[model samples]
Target chain A: MSKKVKIVAATGCPTGIAHTFMAEEALKRAAEKLGVEIKVETHGQVGVQNQLTKEEIRAADGVIVAADKDVDAGRFKGKPTVDVSVSAGIKEAEHLIQQIIDGKARPYKGNSNAESKQEESSEGKSAGGFGRAIYKHLMNGVSHMLPFVVGGGVLIALSFLFGIHSANPDHESYNEFAAFLNSTGGVAFGLMVPILAAFIGQSIAQRPGMVAGFVGGMMANTGGAGFLGGIVAGFIAGYIILLLMKLLKGLPRTLDGLKAIFLYPLFGIFLTGAAMYFVVEPMTTINEAMMSFLSNFQDANPILLGLIVGSMSALDMGGPVNKAAYLTGTALLSDGNFFFMAGVSAACITPPLITAFATVFFRKFFNEQERNAGLVNFILGSTHITEGAIPFAAKNPIVVIPILMVGSSISAILTYIFSVQVPAPHGGFLVLPVVTNGVLWVVAILIGSLVGGFIYGMYQKYSYQKTK
Target chain B: MELLNKNLIKMHTNFQTQEEVFEGIASLAVEQGLASDKKTVVAGLANREKESTTGFFDGFAIPHTKNSAIQKAGIVIMVNESGLEWNSMDGQPAKFFISLLIPENEAGTTHLTLLAAVSRMLVHEDIRAKLLTLENEEKIYEEIKRFLSENM
Candidate 1:
């Protein structure tokens, strides 16, 4: 009789939040379904649980390290191991287990006296594989930056509720409380880009990456390349530090401390700074041209303009394209084009609200957990949190994203037609009183949401029937 | 001194659970005059188990404790034809239960070295496979001693 395959796994995330536990449960369920004997250890905020004993490690056929942050993989040395992000652990646990079963996984040679030589030589060959690794590093940045964005963006909107000029000391209606809120929000916003770059770098080269990444982000800010510039700088900084480590690898063991403290930071900053100045200059120019194009776009046919902007906003759902549209709206707000922001805001809420609506209408299309998530999306959407729709879109991107984009386009066009204007950069329904043609703004959002939800629900129903 | 002597090894035992296997081993430790009391030794093993399960994959468990109830550091090795149900990480029953009892002050010194040695010994597939097939306690002890002396 063939022996039963046995595997051990560890799951962890930076926040030690839902994803860590979710991945653990998902792996367990998948293993059970696949008839594979598996053990999972979770490195959570509470610390490690269900730790793999030394005996278990020795007996296991393979290991899976599903984590966002660094994990001690030393124990799995000489074992076939698959190291991946926690999200992959949640979504592709079966695939990972199958890889181990098929003997496709590489043997993990951790940093031990005998193995470190092989590890270093292999590391020299590949800095890291592309695709998944790149996404993991980028997410490390985005996850850290999100809290600042939400806190700052909402506070800035709240200050506007007191009046657009209430935070200005020279204004007739200047309020100390409004000023405090505005300053605090501004401080958070100021740190957002730097934090994003720092974490991305940290994911790559640890502490040394953070120093270089922070500098790169500051360069982006001063250089006016915005968030895109920050992303480029982060990648450049991380890769440069990685290269430095590789180059200085032959250094004596006693000088290892000097490499991290002096050589890495010094060389990393110098290279990243040069790249940002020389290479990133064109990016800032393009960004400026895009802003100008957006400003000039007001004279174009309103319906066509609304369609393009709305589609762009919904295309990636908080990704680069979405950020571009949102940034354009914020820039135009400064230039006093309030209606541009109104269209942007209307489009932003459409995806999540439509997702919620679809979930409620076509009950059979969603599972219990998803239905609950859909319910939560309603509150998130109403508050202008477009990220609420991300889970739904991520699951069925091909069908869901296109439908969401169409609905968002329709919403934007309607908002433009109704001449709705929003002075604030954020706050969905909460800042409704400050919106000119507020009632029409609400009407445009509802109409777009209903249209999008109906189309998505019909598609789901048809697919479900076909599958049945 | 040889750790897994004939006196400490039990072959083809019928214990059917982790607790039961541990109880049988603790009593053996007392019978061999290596432990002060059977009850205290069993309680120590149970307490250690509560802290973390020592059950490993491929039907092996090493439940251990460092307590004042032990007169000397010793290992009790039990081999069962039928595996005992254990709340192991891999969810597999354990057929080989190696219980260790050490005097409190000597916890981290000799006891830890022996534990490490045992761990290192078990990591080899050939050694484990050979050990599993040996039905005689004297042969099992000889096999373990030869492997450890050669490797360690």
Candidate 2:
């Protein structure tokens, strides 16, 4: 991993409370905005929380001492330093961060006296490692993108209530409200890629990076590279802007104002746009391949997906394995792929419904307790609660779970083959109104249950006869 | 430590000078059991002020100090209707005072986090604007406390 540019800061106020912390927060915010690494030592009422070490001081490219009280800065000699009042640290934090980034600050002209012994205390090393940092940046993008997705997706889904083709205007089911919702939703949805890229860029390199990220993301979208490409564009834009800033650091101080408003953004966007053009080409191919693979789970090989989903749903029903499959389906649903979730929902609905069917089919084989529980499963199955099947499985898990798996598999496979598209993630049969081929989906579930119910009922009858 | 409270917050006071403001803050700190006496608190605040003015932007001053006289870390907020003569960074007469007192032996106590949170809060324009608009001392104390809890 590329190491971040590190800066060391010391903050203190006479009372050692308000100003010290304010300056630290201000510096940290500024450094984060600029995508630089910083370690701040605070001299406060509770004393110093110094994780700053000799190695850190030696490694840091710049030093910032923002204090009203003496923090003993003589140790930072020969390092480029910004020496300022605690108030200035808070008020002019960004400027100081910018100065550090530009490497424009003069080296502190102080003697290094190791003998003076500024307390070398180090502990509580922050665990914000590189992987977590990257995740944080990605989360910043993901979080902002979700709002647009929900707003657009729900409105679009509502348009489907009028009919899937209602937005086409010439369609018979077209209504004015549906058409309006569809188009408005489409417009908002179109911004998802740009917003994702822009926020990621903001996380990586603040304002200039955001500009580049937006433009790059637009290019990625127009190129048909999709959301993954948008992510690539964001990182590229952020890094490119950082690279640009470094390259232009040699410019005269008089041109600083012009560089900010005119030069940096113009050059930054142009470079990121040019870079994304090359990036999007390869990404388009990768994106197309991934999309095809995903759609294949819908268009072909329903049985393979069915077995996997069905088995996982039945294996320790409502356990981690089941949750894993459910989460995967939900994640894909968020990506606007509903087929996996459709199969997953079918699989989950099957096991409980099978047990309900078994009780009715072999009424003589079941006790009163079993009959009552089976009746409850009817309601649970309809609501897509797979855990309702657990009681029956727990009775004879070795035998019963396999039967449940087979029933779930058949339901999932049939749903996929029949092209039943469930727009909503949950609500089971309750979401049937929004589901395409809704009745066929129920028929598919019923067929699986009927077959599995017969086998399960026969087994119970045989066991009951043997016991008698 | 619980940094600020209703007793420490006095709204719409008509202080006319910086010295009187310091005296008022010292008395409040003494009453709150944060400081041993008013004189040491006033002296600490004055001595720190002589080093550099704590007067900040838009008629707000955060006068703070640490001394042997203080028994704890605490804050006193005084919102005066009349402005006092303070050699502030903005050259504006100060009307709002957020005073801080820290005991000399308060090292490693958790009060620093609370104090630092208050110190950092002064930079936000919205909070500063809201502070001047608040009508009651309890509301002001609550607002500051709420902000501190969120930050700390």
Candidate 3:
């Protein structure tokens, strides 16, 4: 028999979470069945494991690198290599292996030591479509930004427990402990935009994209453009750096070092700053216009305004639409309009709670695994995590999403009609003391959850049975 | 391991139905002493199929099982040049059949790995195209061996 085909692979992700190990396992499993000898190196949160030796790299037929972050591909310069996203490693390991086997993979020609080499050119193309790439980059930024928002929002809420004036340094009621909490929380919140832009840039242009991205984010903050502006700035910074890299490809080898350190950042920061000033400045106006429109709703029937905002919050269950509603509310919070956020919070908390209630009331509609997931939604919903409803909606979107939207809308309407105002941007029942009308907010949430759950249960029972 | 030799493979098989193809491979395994109790093995495979179809998008099916009747972990491959009806997820009929038999206790990691390997290999268009051209049993076995050893 001929000699065995040998292959080496690497896997990594931004969070070093489940995807990294999952891809490694998938590659190993695929290799075994194909009767190919293979070794996998995983770069996880705990650090690198099963490091590939130089001998193994030289002897391998090909290399496969599945990573979300930048992975050094210089070691396999002469070898055929296929680079793909971590998800592709899990879903299409066999296809990738076959590409190597068929001699369809490209040779790695990237200079690993050169920081100025256009990182995009040497990198493997993303396996997903354009839409998927955009979504992935956006999520990368959002995931990194969440800790700052949550920590800061919670601390600020805690400070309010000592009396709202306790955080104001000029107020006679100012307490030292409350001031400390407020200041620390303010610092975390201050980092939120910059971190979001930096990661988004990192996702697009690798390490070099981060500097311009952070600068753009800071500009957005200074410009008063908020979250929406941060997103635009991130994309701008990433693409600008990517464009500069491509443009500077013909530079002399001796000057390669200058392109990354001197040229890219200098031009990147200048262009991104210009874009933030000229282009992104207009977004702040749009944001102000949106906030004003929401504020004007106070005069145009509270119930209708509540219905619109509430339904939007639950529309995608923490997806783009939901984030848009929450963003509007948060932006308005800085404008000193807390009533809109009160409606948003109420809407956000109802979907998962309603789903949990449905699972208990209509157990026959859900499978064992789904019922267990439903139970966990109680905690998630109580914490204002609308994403807890995603699993249920994904399974039967036709029935579940409409129910959630309607229920959340009812909650928002009730909260608005009661004139409830929430000063903080986040925190479910945990920040009840800070709400202007806490008891009514609870009443609205419960009513909405019960109505929504009852509707969902009945629909599942009747519709599913008919289909069967 | 000569687990996949001439005895475990049939080229240009004429079976018109999945059931006929499965039964043919099961009997061959029993005849080759790779498995015991052909009836039990066939039934176990059918039960596994009931849970989920093994048919993949690239015109191949891998129906595998671990059963008490399987005395060893082995694979039986059959090629149907004309292709046969299969309820594949991608709605493609299966042309290459790779059926596996493993001892019940050995069906954990090793069995799954082997199954994954075979499934992934057959999913590739180039490999599937190459597989369809080889007409003789020896050539088919050689191809399988080469694929298992070299192009994983």
lDDT of each: 0.75, 0.75, 0.75
Assess every candidate by TM-score.
0.51, 0.41, 0.51
Interface RMSD of each: 13.6, 17.1, 10.1
In candidate 1, stretches whose alpha carbon ends up further than 4 angstroms from where it belongs are A1-130, A311-341, A344-408, A421-431, A434-436, A447-468, B1-152
Candidate 1 vs candidate 3: which has greater TM-score? 3
* Candidates ranked, most accurate by DockQ first: 2, 3, 1
DockQ of the two-chain complex in candidate 2: 0.28
Cand. 1: chain B TM-score: 0.90
- For candidate 2, lDDT tens digit of each residue in A1-468? 277889999998866667788788889888888899999999876778775899999999899988877787878877888777788898788888888888876677452111111111111122434544455556667666655655664566566667556677787877999899889977766787787788777667667778889998888767755555677788888777666666766776567678668876899899988888897676445534534444455444878877777776666454445655676677788888777888889888888788889999898788645676677777667767665565466445567888988888888888888878887666577688888899989998888878778878988999777744
DockQ of each: 0.02, 0.28, 0.03
Return whichever of 2 and 3 wins on lDDT. Answer: 2
Regions of candidate 2 where Cα sits further than 4 Å from its true position: A1-128, A161-163, A282-301, A305-414, A417-468, B1-152
Q: In model 2 chain A, which range of ten residues has the least summed lDDT?
A: A114-123
Model 3 fnat value:
0.00
